[model samples]
Target: MPIGDINVPIVGKNVVIAVLVQSHILFAAFIIGAVLIAATSEYMGMVTKQPRYERFARNLARFVVLLFASGAALAITFVLALVTLFPVFFSYLQNIFFWVFLVEAFMFLGQIIIVYAWYNVWDKLAYRKNLHVVFGFIAGFFGLMAMTMIDAVASYMLTPAEAPATDVARTFLNQTMVPLNMHRFVGNFGYAGFLIAGWAGFRYLKSTREDDRAYYDWMGHWGIIWGFGFTMLQPVIGYGYMKGIRESAPDAFDRIMLDNAFTFNLLMIWLTVLAVAATGYFVHKLRFSVRPMPFLRKLAIGGLAFTALFSVLNLIPADGHIATGITFLGGEETQIPLGGMYPWKYIGLIGLMLVGFFVVALYLRASASGFHWGNASRWSQFALIACSVTIVFTMVTMGYTRESARRVDNDPGYLIYKCITLDQKVVSENCPAVSDGVNTISGREAG
Candidate 1:
C-alpha cells in the first residue's frame, strides 16, 4: 500500500511517530550510557578495593534492567507505527539497508541476552569479579554495535550518500554518519553520568542514615566526573558533525546556522551558561583545605567570564539584514552575527570548550591530591543537580535543532532527504480510489 494514502481520522501520524521515537531515543540513550558508567565503577571497585564502587555499580545495573525493558517496549511500538502507517517508506529503507538492519537485530538480541544474564548472576559471579566485569563489557559492546547500526540509518536521512542504492556499503557510510556516531557515542556517556549525579543528589538530600548520605555523596561526585569529562569533548566533535552537514547539504546548514541562527544560539547560550556555572561551582567546592592553584583559579575565573560574554553575544539579535549570498525558505527568520561568522563564533565556542576542560582537569587534580568529595559543600551537590538539568535540556534542544533543520530545509519536506513519501506527494482529488492501498478517501478504518 502507498504510504500516507490512508490518514486515520482520530490520530495525527506525525505526532504519534514523533512522541514514540523521541521517547525511545531518550530511554535507549540512558540505558546505553549507564552500561559504560556501571562497568567503570565495577572496575574501580576491583582496582581500588572499594566496596562502595561495586555497590554503586550493582545498583546501576538493576536500574538499567528496568529502563531497558521500557526502552525495548517503546522501540517495538515505534517500529510498529512506522510499518503500519508508513509501510512504503519503511519498505524502501529496508530494501536499501537490509544488511544494516539485519546486523542491528542480532546485536540487539545479544545485548538483551547478555544484559539479563549478567544482571541475574551478579551475586553468583561475585567471587570471580573479573569475569563479571567482562560480562558487563560484553553487554556494553553489543549495545554500542546496535546503536552504531541505527546511527548509520538515521544519518543517511540527513546526508545521504551520493553513491547509487546498489552500493550498500557506500550508502551505509554516508558523510555525516561517522561524525554523528562519534557525537552520540560521547553524548550517551555524558547524559548518563549527569542523570546518575542528579539521582545521587536526590538520594543524598533525602537520606537519614549517615552511611547512606556519604555513599550517595560519593556516587554524585563520581557521576559528575564522568559527565563533565565527556561533555568537554563535545564541542570539537559537534563542529565536525556540523561541517559534514554543511558540506553535504548547504541550504540545510544555512537554515540552521544563519537563517535560524537566533533560536539555535539561544540553546547554545543556555547550554554554555549552565554547564560552565555548574562545573565551576563544583570545582571551587572541590578545593579542600589546600587553596586552589592560583593559576588554575584564574583560568576558571577567565572561563566563567568568557562564558558570560559568549552567552550575551549569542543572545544579541542580528541586524535585520540576512547574511548575503545565502537563500532560505524561512525569510522571516532572524540571524545572529555571532552565530553567522567564522573566528568570531569560533572564538566564543572554543573558549567555552577550553574552560570546560580546565574545570574538569582542576577537579581531577584536586581529587588525586586528597581533596575528599565526602567533605564537599552542600551547595556543590546542588550544583551537580543543576548540571544534570542542563544536560537533559541540552539533549532536547540539540535534538530539536537537528530534526527541525531537516524539515524546514527539505525540498517538498521529504522525511528522508531526496526520498518522496505520501506527505509530500500529491494525489488527484477526483481520481478513483486506490484499492491496492488503504484508502482514507471513503473513510475506511485504518489500523
Candidate 2:
C-alpha cells in the first residue's frame, strides 16, 4: 500500500486529524492537572483537617478515573488516523522518536495503575493519609512525565533542531521545547481549574441542601484560585514560547501572527474575557466577605477597570486586513493606531500581568479572612461560568493558531516543518531517504 493514499470524504483528512487530536488534548490536559490538584487538595485536607477539602479531593479523583478512558481512546484514534493519512511522515517520526514514544507509553501505563490504586484505596488508606497522598502525587507525576515526552515531539514538529535527526537529545531538546512545555504545564491547571469552578458553580445553583450549597460554593472558590492564579502567568510564558518560534521558524510565526492575524486577535479577546471576568468575580464576591474590608474591595474594582483597559489595548488589530486578505478601509493597507506589537501590545501584556498579580493578591488576602459561602450572588456564579466558556474557546483558538501556522496561503504545508511535506515526502537535507526498504542518511545506510 502506498503512503498518503487514504483520504476522508467531504471534510478531508486534516480536519479529522485536527478534531481528534484537539479533543484528545483537551481531555489529556485536564486529566494531568486534575490529578495534581486532587493530590494537593488531599494533602491540604490532611494538614488543615478540612473535611471539605477531603471531599473535593475524593470526588475529583473519581472524575479523573472516569475521564481517563475517554482521553486514552481519543489518543489511540488520533495515532491511527495519523498513520493512515500521513504514513511516510509517521514512519519518519517513529524512527526518530522511538525512545520518546516508549517512555511515554510506560509513563501512561504507570499513571493508569497509580491513579486507580490511588482512588480504590481511598477508604483503606484513611488511617494512612500520608501514604494515600503520596500515591496521588505519584500518579500526577506519571501523567506529567507522559505530557513532557509528548511535548518534545510536538515542539520538534514546529522547530526541528539543526542537528541530525538521529541525535536524540538535540531533537528532543529543540529550541521551543522548554517554553512550550512550560506554557502547557501552566495551561493545564488553568484549564482544569476553570472547568472545575464552572461545574461547582452550576451545582451550587442547583443544590437545595444547605450543606451541599456550602460545599459547592467552597469548591468553586478553590477552583477559581487555581484557575486565575495560573492564568496570570500565561502571557509571560506564552511570549517566551512565541519568541522561540519567531527565532526558529519565522515563516511559521508570520503565518499566524501576520497573515492570519485574526486568530491571534481572537486569542487576545478570549484572554481579556478570562482576566476581566475572573477579576469581576473576585470583586463581586468580596462584597460578601466575612470580614469588613471595604478598602480591598475598592482596590479590586480599580484592578478590574485597568484589566479591561489593558485587554482592549491588546485586542486592537495592527491592520485593517483580516484573514481573508481583505482590507476593510479599501486602501493601501490601513494601519490601526495603538495596535502594533512593539510598544502597545507589549505594554498591554505587561500591564495585564502586573494588574493581574495585584488583583489576585487582594483576592487571596480577602480569601484568608474568609468569605460567606453559599451566599454568593447569582451574577458572581455566572461570571465563573463565563470564564469557563471563554477558556474553552481560548484553548481551541490557540490550538488552531499554532497548527494552522504550517499552512501556507491556505495550502497544505509541511508536517514537520521543512523536513516532511503534508503529502509524506521528505524534502530537506536533514531528512533520511528510504531506498529498497532500507533507510539511508547522507548515502550511509542507517542501522
Candidate 3:
C-alpha cells in the first residue's frame, strides 16, 4: 500500500468539495442565525410594543427567504460532487447513516416550506403576530434538527463509535457528535450575527439619512451583541469538542493540535484577531461616555498590546525550540494549545479571552452607570467589519484543519475510522466474492 495508491487522480476534487461544502454551511448558518435574531426581535417587539423591532424582524426574515434558494443549490451541488468524485466514500457513509440522512432531508424540507410561508405571510399575519412568531420558532427548530443530523454524520466520520456492530443509533451517537453539534450550534449564531452586523455597518456608511444611519447603527449593535456573545461560548464548547477528539482519536487529535503547528498557529492568529475585534467593539461602544473610565481604557489597551504580541509570535515557525518560562490561563502561562502547535498561543488565546471578558464586564458596568448608544464612531463599525472577515476566515481554516487531520498519516483516509478507508480502487472491480484476511475495494481496505 503506497501512499495515494488508492486515490484516483481527480485533480482539484478536494478543493471542489471544500468550496461547495463550506459555501453550503455558510449559507445554512446564516439562515439559522437570522431565524434566531428574527425570533428574538419579534418577541421583544411584541412584549415592548416597539415597531422598530418588528420592522427589523420582518426585514431579516425577508433576507433569509432571498438566500434560501442559493443555499439549497449549494447543498445539492455539494452532495453531487461527493457522489461523483468519491462514490465509494459517499456510498459507505450513506449505507451506514441512511436514517440520519433521511431525517435531515425531511427537516430541510420542513425548513424550506416553513421559512417561505413565514416570510410570505408577514404582513397578512400582522394581526396574529404571536402565531407568526410560533412559525418562526418551528422553522428554527427544523433548521436545528437538520444541522444536528448533518453534524452527527460528519462527526461520526472523524470519530466513529467504538463498537464492532454497525448499529445506526450507536454510530450516530459517536463521542464527538454532540460536541461538534454544540460548537456548530453556537457558531451559527455568531457567524450570522457578524454578517448582519457587517452588512449593517456597510449600510450605515452608505446612508445619507440620519434616521437610516441611526437604524443601521442600532441594528449593527444588536447583531454584534449576539455575534460576540455566542462566539464567547465557542472557546469553552470547542475545548470540549477537541477533548472528544482527543479521547476518540488520539493520533488525529495530536496531528491537529501538536503535529501541525502552522495551521494551529493560524488558528491562534484568528482567535487573537477575533479577541481584538470583539474587545475593540466594546471599547468603541463606551469610549464616548460622559464620565471618564481611565481603568477600563487602560485594560483594553493592554489587551490589544497582548493580542498584537500574540499575533506576532504566531507567525514564528514551530520547528525551532521556543523559550518559555511558565503558563497560566487568562493571564500569561502558555501551554495546552487547542489543536495548536505553538505553546505561547495557549497564553495568547486565554489572555485575549480574559481581556474580552473584562472588556465586556466593564461595558456592562458602564451601561448601568450612564453609557448610551447615542452614536458609535464609524471606526467602531469598521472594527465589526474586520471581525466578520476574520470570523469567516477562521471558519474556513477550521474546516481545512478538520479535513486535513483525517489524512495526517499520509495513507488512505478512513471513511469509518479504522474499518473503512478511502482510496482509488473501484469497489465493483476490486471486491472479491469470497473474503480473504485482507480486502481492498473501492479504495477501502478491510480485514
Runs in model 2 deviating more than 4 A are: 410-412, 430-447
The candidate, 1 or 2, that scores higher on TM-score is 2
Against the true structure, candidate 3 has what lDDT? Answer: 0.74
Candidate 3: residue 49 Cα off by (Å): 2.8
Model with the higher lDDT, candidate 2 or 3 = 2
Give one digit per residue, the lDDT tens place, for model 3 in 144-211: 99999999888877776654225667778878999999999999998898888888888888888877
Q: Write the per-residue lDDT of candidate 1 for residues 121-235, one digit (tens) a residue.
A: 9989989989999999999999999999999888877666665555677778888999999999999998899889888887888887878887888888788878877887887
Alpha carbon lDDT at 435, candidate 3:
32
Candidate achieving the largest lDDT: 2
Of the pair 1 and 3, which is ahead by TM-score? Answer: 1
Off by over 4 Å in 1: 1-3, 8-11, 289-299, 320-340, 409-411, 421-447
The 0-to-1 C-alpha lDDT of every candidate, in the order given, reads 0.74, 0.88, 0.74
Worst 10 residues of 3 by lDDT: 426-435
**Cα lDDT for residue 42, model 1?**
94
CA RMSD of all predictions:
7.2, 3.3, 6.4
